[model samples]
Target: MEAAPTPTLLLAPMEGLLDFVLRDVLTRVGGVDRCVCEFIRVTGSLLPDKVFYRFIPELRNGSRTLAGVPVRAQLLGSDPSSMADNAARLAELGAEGIDLNFGCPARTVNRHGGGAAMLREPERIAAVVAAVRRAVPAHLPVSAKMRLGYDDPGSAMQCALAMQDGGACEVVVHARTKADGYRPPAYWERIAPLRQALRVPVVANGEIWNLQDAQRCRALSGGDALMLGRGMVADPGLALAIRAADAGGQGEEAPVEVRWQALAPQLARFWHLVCKDLDPPQRAGRLKQWLNLLRRRHPQAQAAFDQVRVMTDQRAITLWLQQLVAAAATADGQAPADPAA
Candidate 1:
């Protein structure tokens, strides 16, 4: 019998989060096929090569993550000419693919006529994609990430078809309009219509909190690929679990102690990498953001996060982490307490 193809699962790139360290850690957990870099805003002249390297350091090695997973560079902009120019530069820098961000709902992005706001103008979306396709290398894949619409689901189908006509290889819909903004119960049903409307591959995104959610999303969109976001932060092994369940393998739940023990090193690694480029205070804030998500999986994550948050002094934060690690070791075999609770 011919083997079924391995489903493609992508890790959605989050700005000011999901840096190289986090990507490295999550990719190790398995089942993630591709990773997209945070959107690099292209406003004016073509970005210098260093800018591309800074946002997508993976491009240094032909856009491959540390684990050999391919990473695509994502761009956010309103100008088709500038976007196409930048896409060409990214391709020259060895980027394997280019992803356009039309899904972000941030007011700043929307006000700039970018992100979800672009959905209101299907012609502009098509023009941007067409221009970029013309400029970039033919073999380099160009994809787009979009929300359902600005304020209504009705607009998405037309926008999606426009993106397809404009030459996008695939479109990833976040399953909600701009107004939804990370709320509960994502309308996966809405994505179904958009999928049927477009000839390009559709990858579903949003509110996929577990294996069941993933299955439901696949059924809804008739899509084989999925893009995971915040859910991935709460449970790093979610993709692995989903893959296991799909393969008829039983899922193993890691004990709280094991979860924390595994996370501590990852936290430290992320901190170390950020500190190398960012100042101490900025690095600390980034650490807190990660801990905020880590706390969801292992409640005990707060003890370390709180220590880092309260202490303004960098040296003190480092000392507190050392003590927390020591304390965690001594509390072996006990049910992990929820520090955030």
Candidate 2:
């Protein structure tokens, strides 16, 4: 009897957030196969090795975490020649794979002819991917990440075909237009035609906040895989739950669901890593940012967020988190209420 394969869970690359530190924590949760580093912006000149190392210093460790998960480096730019040149450098630096970022919605990035702005000109996508493809070894995989379109969802199919013509090994559609910008009710079904049109595999992204959402996304996108961002951040155990259900009790790690009450110890570990890399202000901001997302899943996280909303000290926040965990454990006799409610 053959068992179904576990779905590939990818931790998304979110710039200015979810850096290498966060990647380490999430991938350690056991279901994530690999993670993409935040996008490194490439302009006219080739960036130095230090720039790549700064965003993904794990390159020194074979571009992997301590757990041995692979981390692909992602670059954001529109120039064919410069992008190819940088892609060559990344490959030379021992990148297992390279990802092109055409889906970023930052006005600054788009205004400079990068990110989702490139969607307006689908032909140029072919040119850039073709250039990068030619520069790298033909055997090496080059993938793209992008939104459905600039303003309308109508551009998705054409844009996806452009990547195929450009020689991308796979394309990831974020299930929303550049205009959607993290709004609710992602158009997961819109990705179906694009996935059906391409020769390469299509990975769906967006609005997968839980196991139910993940299942719904799979059915709607008809995708080969799923790329998780804020959803994984909110519930680090989501991918594990999905994997456990698929394995049908055959997997090594039993499924674990993370509730806000149970998340304090993990957050403590996450904070420890955050402080090692970021300054005081940055550390405080990072904690708040994660709590803001976790709040959606765990109402208890709201109390934690409120505790540190004004505090600049990570240590203080850690103590408050520990106390909250203790209180929650005591209140419900070990089973906390649903935070979503």
Candidate 3:
């Protein structure tokens, strides 16, 4: 009997939020197949190699995170020539793949005729994808991330077909229009027809927060692959939990879900990375930002957030994290971890 293929789980590129640091922590925790780096906004001139390295330090580590998951460098721009040029440079820099950004809803991006603004022009979308495809090596996959449409889903199919016509190997559709904007009740159902219409694989994104949501998303989107963003951020073990649930349903033992105790080490690891890599002024806020999101899934995170919410001193925050890690490790019956490490 033939075994089913493993579902492809991709960590989404969230500009300003899910950079290489968080990507490293999440991928290390396990079960993500690939990650797309935050979009590198390419304009008229060719960007320096340092720019790519800055956004995706993994590029220096063979375009993979420290955990060794392949990272695809994403490019966002309106000019096909410039996008193609920059993508060629990314390929030369040994990028595993190149992903286009057509889904960013930022007004600044839209005003510049980048991101979701391209959804309004299917022809332009096709051109940008085609140009980038032509520039990069054929073996290197070129993909795109897009919203359903600019304001509504009326042009969704046309835009998707444009991407296909332009030779994108895969397309990830965030199931909402630009107007919808990160609200509850993601229109997972809208992805079904796009999946049906596209020849290449269509991965569904948006609002998948847990196992039940993953199941419902698969059922509604009619696709096995998923791209996770904020949902995965809120719960670091979401991908593993989904995979375990899937395996358990197929008569395998389901491992215990990752609890806050297990997550303490990862949080400590995150703080270590933040302190080591980021600037001093940014360190405290970065920790607080993650705790703010983490509080959504774990009550322990709420306590942690409360403890650090008023703190701006890096040394003070570090001390708090060290204590937190030690307490969590003790609760789990293990030796305390070096939070500074």
Candidate 4:
């Protein structure tokens, strides 16, 4: 039998959670093949280039993160004509790719008749996708993401088929109904039939927090591609670890440890960028938000979170992080890169 091809690992486009700032820092850690920017809500307007740039700053840098990973812009809306018009502009702006978001389960998004609400109307899904596909150049890749269904897994295959029929080159199934709402057990098996039937690639996503989950997701979904979300945020080394295990061949591979010593610099760099780019009020919260998630996988992050939990001042947080980075560098026998620098 011919050998199976290597899997393509993508970073999931988490709204508010995984914006360009985190995307830049995480991609810098390496192993991610591509990233999808957070969903740009298209209402009825053509949405100026600034709107696209505001959401996906990478468009200014050749549609790629500073680390050079291509970032695809995602659009969420119910209006097929508006979606098609915006997609055409994104294409003209030189987006690396376009991804339609039909999987967002936020109440605000759903209340607007966008996101997973569209899953309730498969014909609408097909019309929007076909419209966007027609608007973009033939060489540009158009993709779509969706849950198993609005409330159950009943329409999973129908929605997947709709995406394929609408000219999406690839489709990513999050493996749970929107009603499941980021719950445990992502129903990886549900993706198997969709993978088998779809002509385009099917990428499995959801609840893959560790190497074991990645292995099992691939085994059950029977697909090579996977999209990482909170898992990657909680453990920045996840994608690289998954890649290492993949290359190591058929056995239980040891977990790849991402030491605090290594992560200290990334923390420092994230802070630097946050201070540089974001407003004063938003800066401190961003670091704490990341540490809150980081504490899921790293005990050290719990301590770090405790120290900065009440800090609203960016200067105070900067001082605390500098000390943390310096301490880590000392233990690792290296000179620290100043956190403020």
Which is the leading candidate under TM-score? 3
Cα lDDT computed for each candidate against the true fold: 0.81, 0.83, 0.90, 0.91
For model 1, residues 241-328, the per-residue Cα lDDT tens digits are: 7777667776543323236765554555565566666766687787788788877767787776776666566666666655565565
TM-score of 4: 0.95
Q: Tell how far residue 300 is off in model 2, in angstroms.
A: 2.6
**Residue ranges of candidate 1 with Cα displaced over 4 Å:** 251-258, 319-341
For residues 1-341, could you state the per-residue lDDT of candidate 4 as single tens digits?
A: 98778789999998778999899989988889999999999999899888899899999899999989999999999999999999999999999989999999999999999999999988999999999999999999999999999997989888999999999999999999999999898999999999999999999999998888998999999987999999999989888888887888443322334676788988999999888878888888889999999998888999899989988887788888888889988988899976444
In model 1, how large is the Cα lDDT of residue 181?
A: 88
Query: All candidates' TM-scores?
Result: 0.89, 0.89, 0.96, 0.95
Summarize candidate 3's per-residue lDDT along 177-267 as a digit string, tens digits.
9988888888889999999999999999999987778889999999889999998898888888778876665422223446888778788
Worst 10 residues of 2 by lDDT: 332-341
Judging by lDDT against the true structure, name the best candidate: 4
Better of 2 and 4 by lDDT: 4
The Cα RMSD of model 4 versus the native structure comes to 2.0
Question: What local lDDT does model 3 show for residue 261?
Answer: 82
- Model 4, position 36, has a per-residue lDDT of 97
Cα lDDT of model 4 overall?
0.91
Where does candidate 4 stray beyond 4 Å? 1-4, 249-257, 338-341
